[model samples]
Target chain A: MAAISVELFAYPWDILEATPERFLDHCVALGVTRAHVTVSYHSGKFLLPRNRSVRVYFPEPGALYFQPDAAAWAGGLAQPVSRLAGSGWLERLARGAAERSIELSAWAVFFHNSALGAAYPDLAVQNAFGDVYPFALCPSHEAVRDHAAALCRSVAALGIFSGVDLETIGYLGYFHGHHHEVTAIPLGMAEKFLLSLCFCPACRAACGSAGVDAESLAAAVRGLLDRRMQSDDASGGQDEEAEHVATLLVACPALAALIRLRMETVTALVKRLSVEAGSAKLAAFTSSFVGSPSNIWMEGVSPTDVGELVECFHLLAYAPDVAQVNSELVFFLALTSDPARVNLTLNLGLPLTTSFSQAAAKVEYALRQGVRRFSFFNYGFLGEARLRWIGDLARIARGDSR
Target chain B: MTELRAGVIGHGYTGKLHASAWLANPHAALTAVADSDASRLAGLPAGVRGYSAYEQLLADDLDAVSICLPTHLHAEATLEALARGKHVLLEKPIADNLRDARRMLMAAKAKGLTFYVGMTHRFYPELREAKAQIDAGAIGEIVAANDCVLEHLGFLNVPQWYLEKKFAGGGAALTSGVHLVDRLRWFLGDDVRAVAGRAGNSYFGADVEDSGQMFLYFRSGLSAQITFAFMREEHPLVCDLQVIGTRGSLTVHTWQSYELWNNSGRQRKVFYTQEPHPAKVQAGIAGEVEEFRASIVEGRTPWPSAEESTRAVQAILAYYESAATGRLIEIGDLHAV
Candidate 1:
């Protein structure tokens, strides 16, 4: 097994509230040499049980934690900032990390901004039925692409981060974990893929440019989704998801070309953003709340296409045991040839890793598969005991006695 | 005058209540009961007829029928009974969706047959008393209200259809919280202008949600918040509501007790403990059934009209729409859909 290095994922508010010294001390105790702090994020109501301050935190919508290059994003579709940036909390944390010889990286979310989308409705992802999903910016829009690139460039300009973990860089679907999601109608994989397909003006234009019939495809998708919703039968089981998607693509061959166009659009954006983050490493999450890596296509993410551009792929193996983690790694490895460029990001707390042994086992299995780096999800959201499990995982990875 | 003959289409929990109410109402006689399950139809009263299919029961002699089938079947059953020239008392939530609800209402209107919704909670004595007081300005001008129901309708407690989304339309919100929404609408005598809601199936992880929360904004400057769940296994069923007005506040709990507080330093409380006598508990449904008969006998509209029930359904659907969109949904937009 390769030597293991674990990085802690945290938020800037958590550092300021816990104080840099205390936060870094906890990181060091867990053998964590690096930390990924959220630089740009979307709106959410979080539960921080271990925090010294408020138990619940509602962050500013689409907030940029660090100071952004004001001149860079002039006349942009999205304008969002966190009040904490004025307090210099991120810079203070960065300075603290520099003094302690701990590496800090910016965890930036790019397109999933409800505030920005709401402000510019035309820029958001519009479904085939012409309903705007204000939470997800349509990547086909050049302005949205520019906004994402500017976000990355601004984070890199801070000069306090080693890398930026780009989240939601591609297209988002109808179910992007908004405040109160009422999806009473259980959607099959094919139906969800159909819903996630963007029919925005830019997307349609892109499809037209790619020589694919966009109008008919959108109408077909709409008809299929409506019929499926109205049907009395429940959604098919997970095992039939792939078969269903295959059947759909076969029936609507135009959908295949459209999907490929979307993948190309995502790849082009990642390629552009990587160039913008000149000095900082460009890493992307392989999965989201949409599904596992197997269902990345729902987000217009093709790992094989993206793997060639980004420095690393953070395989979100947020599973309950080593077996699930193994399946995820197998699927991701098949897409990306170099396992060395892959890092395993696991939840260090309950519902995923219930015991120290389970955490150690996942790390060990990933190590055997040639994944050397592991990033433990969430510093403040995790309790003290889970933090200790991280230290044990690091020791086991390094073949240490402790 | 000859008594109105009534038959119950579904023999579920609410169906049984409708059956008992028909039998209890002197103006209405329980004629027949129909259920897909023969077991549910086995123990009917000596004089009452039993049919395996509701179509058979609707064909029999009856003045009105309480359509207590699953939410998805409410429109089909009601429309069929209406075609047979029988006055219909459809259950709460006129239908699962607006289109079907509108269809049922139109069918009844075209046929000139009396149609009413069984928003049974409106007839609960405590709620009725609270409504009377609110009407008499006991609570003054209403400002805000909150309703909560944490029931125990887990997988083992309910039939499979209750947990299925297609059949039940929704879980706790549509099935249980509909009553709360309708009652609040009735108390305020106002229409919900907009709604925002959140629902989850984290507990049972079934096709339907076991929990829901909603915020309703009325056009009359009134606001209400309703939270309900059917996930608690050990927790006893609790259904309560609190209405706050300019002069005072009124609270009703499970139709068992009520309390009123006025700004003038006067507080009045009424409590009915000791497992409310079965007759008293059944009185709400009996009153609902009686009202159904009275509407037909006098050729007047029912207490809770079909339009009122359709609006209640619209509010509930708006809750779902708000939850789905993660934004406040205007009730008018639901009508457009």
Candidate 2:
């Protein structure tokens, strides 16, 4: 008498705006008992009318759905922008889901308000160097959390979705360590590379409360750097081999503590928010290079840590959309397409299932792996081909279809 | 009765700059240069001894020290120097974060040692002139200010420590944009009340941001916009400031060129004759050194004290909070932490 559980990726807003009847019928046809819907895109609506004649105004005025406590909504409400051709679309989509007996989990990408960044220059992240990254919002800002929570509440109030899935919470990169060719290192090793922790008051206070000696840590780092440079010089400076080893010695524990503290803070915040929501379950989709055995450049995380995170988030309760397992091969190939590295090339081109299937099967084979809760990147591929895999995956997850 | 001797910590770019500045200044004498990199100290100018460990450097008979190490090291080095009864000149962004910044400030204050933040931009002749003019009511009451700092990604490729979250802190905002934010806060003559910002790693793939934008709302009702990026092809280290007021507006280019526009008359005046900061490089070092010297001798307080820098730190943190949450974060919210 167990429920036949199946999770589907549904773009309800887009579907309703495009083909209301077909979208409704498709949900029924797939026997989709549950749907993970994308409530907000990076810039807004994903599927806009193909009419070249339609002029789209960003921040579509009253179109933005906010939580009750959202202070930023005052500005949004005051300005009346055009709604995506279809208004009151969520109600119709919810009705369709209800008719088909499908559960919907409203999914949103938090800390990314690309539209707001463009419309209001004040709401963007500025680097110390004075470059404004338009899409990302400050994680520590109350307004960001409040606004996001407001949006989630609005979606939940519709009586359509079962819960909300907050996708991609702490996904950020520094230009120096992540993008710059010279300083850029593998994602696994990146934690050890940066020269400063955010001296921003919030992070500093958080670190201090966590019993971290930010100054001592910095001093230790400087000491390590000094030692490394000396070692490098002694070794003829031809290679940074000695320096790398020295840095590793000093950086590992420091970086680990820093990351652990940050993760704890973030996890606690998310958990607190979820508790406040009463019924909603919070989930974070995190990308890690530590999943791969070949990620030797950086200290790989212990399997225990992985298990702890899984248990903490209760990931098993909800179906995963696409868990992209990255490794040395993927990172290497993505960085450069050198023919000399055939293994990396092959892995990059291979499917996520192939790259991680063995390890994934060993760990939790029945669980939905490499599955996305909400489609953020590569929507077209995910919508057409990936969803089929996801459906089959849901059936397998339920121990039925396979 | 005795001349003040100082040592330079971490002979990197900033360290070397500090060492050279010390050698050039009369009030302070370069006693020792301590760096782990023996090769980096190979060609030290005459009369300066290079030590492998900071302990050895601290043992030297020095009245003060300039910490030109990484952002994370500023607090530790400065604290050690201060604990040794040495006045300190710590580099900008103060400490890696606010807690460390406060600790450094408190430590220095407790010891009655002169501790000054190396906010070099404040020493720029143009900014100084601009500040003076604004204070004199030449530009009238400040209404708004905007700063854009764009540079090539080449600078992002420093040591790995420059990118690590533990060391460098947050990406562009902490490393490069801090200068702009501090300058804006200084020029506005008020503290940043609230902030909304966005940051991400779209460029290289590090966990920190390569490009970011921040909005700062000063307590004085003056708002400022700052953009920090490593995406540009050219390394254009431009700190262009546009200060608007009810009477007129002033645009500063290169911190030297000044253009003033009278709002009522709709007339513009371009002044290209003013000389740039004469002791620009030495200004921060000299001012900090003089303060340290005076504090050690005359028992006076330093300018741009650690407490003042804390406000700047809070402003940056507010921006980060806004960036992470995609909402307006008040300065009080940041201080609450």
Candidate 3:
């Protein structure tokens, strides 16, 4: 495992708005030694924009990408918006960071590109009914794979980025943060999972080559989802999502092979990106929203084989309860190569409804789970008090003060 | 923002209640309060400024306003607050009439202010979990619903206008029934196709109804039968919702949740929050207000937007129309033009 100290997630806008010196000063004051800044990001309509030049809705493709000399890539731009003409943004940060001694980590968002997906809709993920979700780029597509490798190289070229935090580099799922999204069709989580299963040409061909009957499975899935939507039965127990998967797998034994194939695709993509990184360490950013037990399989981004290639697993443990946080760490660690390489991120505000003591306890439990390093979510999003709580946890993590 | 400055309007029962909530909320402070009756406004905790009129309260800087006024004044207070570019957490039954509700929504939108409709159910942990799971499509597609909230009105301590139709709107249905009505539309869908009801004042004799039986048809092929009454026994508050879906069924109450399916055995999940009534009420207000504060600071939309709350008001209005004409009222008739 690569050695890492206390880190705080940040944004370039945060640096530009607060000015690099002031932002670095704030980091120093908070006792943070590193900043994982987003280079490529998505377009968002924030609540109070222009007033405060900080925070974003969600992480999207953030950094510029290089067309690797080895791959034949025709995709215009992998990311939707360009920071444009370098903005001398990375250079300025590197200069500012050099003075403050704050190590910079490029937070790279690989997929979930509205811009690229919209342009090459065929490269985007296709649902069971053949509905193309342009927001999610299919990992099977050569362009996406090529773009990912290029992205890693581009961030490493920034000179200031000492490490890389990889986000959404694998399969994009049904879950998205598109505001005001109307779920007109009440699709169950399992049904949505079925829909997220890419029946696109690439996925189908791969499944066929692997001896899995992709065509019949897709039909069966479509029929199952349609029937469930029409059934409206209320007696389903707590394990309905599990039940749905079990029932489907029983009907088509080949479905398990399809899932295994997905894991291989994502693993290969990461390995290629890891090779492209040269010396920069890769940290897999994994969060299943709220303690989803089967998130790795559901998203098809298992961190087992890539442990040697990747630096650390940046696990998101946002739940308030210490037990829940422990459970999340246990689940991630059981699958991860080295438990010590896991860097757990805890929520300090907004989504967290627990007290500061409870939040501190979550950090304590995560540390007990053999997680060596720790990082809070983006410094700009949380309230000042939560930021203070981060300082308190820093103290608590070291067992220096209560 | 570290903390939010909030004020409560109308020193009615809930007004005093939510003011204390704001004070107790870690993210909020009860900076100012307004009540028409000075006597009602008396005995407030220290440091909270007082006002006789809501307009005076609006003059002061406020991030959000919790309108605890009567049903009649809900629209005016909310409008006054929104017009001043303040976020609002108006209590249920956003307005007495749909017109005022629309006006308030438009004003809030024009200013880009968040309007959070305060529902007590939002505070219940188990209820919120059920709502989230339902939103995630756990129980296939909804086909039928059964919901009821029965309580004795005499035990409900409030101002005198509650007995008057003009001030409180209708009695049992508007006050207590709106909670379940909002929950149904929220958990089900806002596209309530039809509504029919029969209500009476025989129990309380307050000129407003004490018992209400309302039936609602949803566009998602789900029909809900809701019953609300003012029970005097005080045995306990009976509030539960049972939703039937194609693949499964779920019965959710404040304290318990149960899921049942065709071939599977029923599973019951019970959570006990056995605090006293006053403590529960205080917690509910504080939880909602804290959430409202967080929404403002975090730049996120509040749960169940004002537009969604309007559907609750719309359903109640349909129920009234049905009771008046002794016929089913199509929900489309209540749609704002």
TM-score on alpha carbons, each prediction: 0.54, 0.43, 0.51
Question: Candidate 1's residue-wise lDDT over B1-337, tens digit each?
Answer: 3689889999865687788788878777898999998756654677999999999998999899998888899888999999999999988777778999888888999999999998878777788888888888988988899999986653213456777989998888888888998998998888899999998998789887789899999998889999998864534456889999899999887645787888666555554422212334456778888888998999999988888878888898888888888999987843464
Ranking by TM-score: 1, 3, 2
**Which candidate, 2 or 3, would have the higher TM-score against the true structure?**
3
Q: What is the TM-score of chain B alone in each candidate?
A: 0.93, 0.88, 0.89
Q: How far does residue B127 in candidate 1 sit from its true spot (Å)? A: 44
By TM-score, is 1 or 3 better? 1
lDDT by residue (A203-298, candidate 2, tens digit) is: 445558777776666565566545544553432322224355346546567555665665554554465456444565544433332223222122
By TM-score, the best candidate is 1
Candidate 1: stretches off by over 4 Å: A1-3, A235-240, B1-337
lDDT of 1 at B250: 90
Instruction: Summing lDDT over every window of 10 consecutive residues in candidate 1 chain B, give the lowest-scoring window.
Output: B271-280
- What would the per-residue lDDT of candidate 3 be over residues B1-337, giving only the tens digit for each residue? 7878888997665776787688778777888999887755554567788999999999998888899988888877888888887899998878768888888888887888888888777677667777776676677777788998766443222346766899888787888788888788777765788899998877767888888899988887678999988754432456788888777777886544445444355666755422223444556677778778888888888776667777787888889999999999887654448
Candidate 2: count the clashes: 85
Q: Compared with the true structure, what per-residue lDDT tens digits does model 1 show for residues A262-369?
A: 989999989888888888888888665656665676688778888888877888888786787888898888889888778888887667777777878888887888
Best by lDDT: 1
Sequence-dependent TM-score of model 2? 0.43
Winner on lDDT (2 vs 3): 3
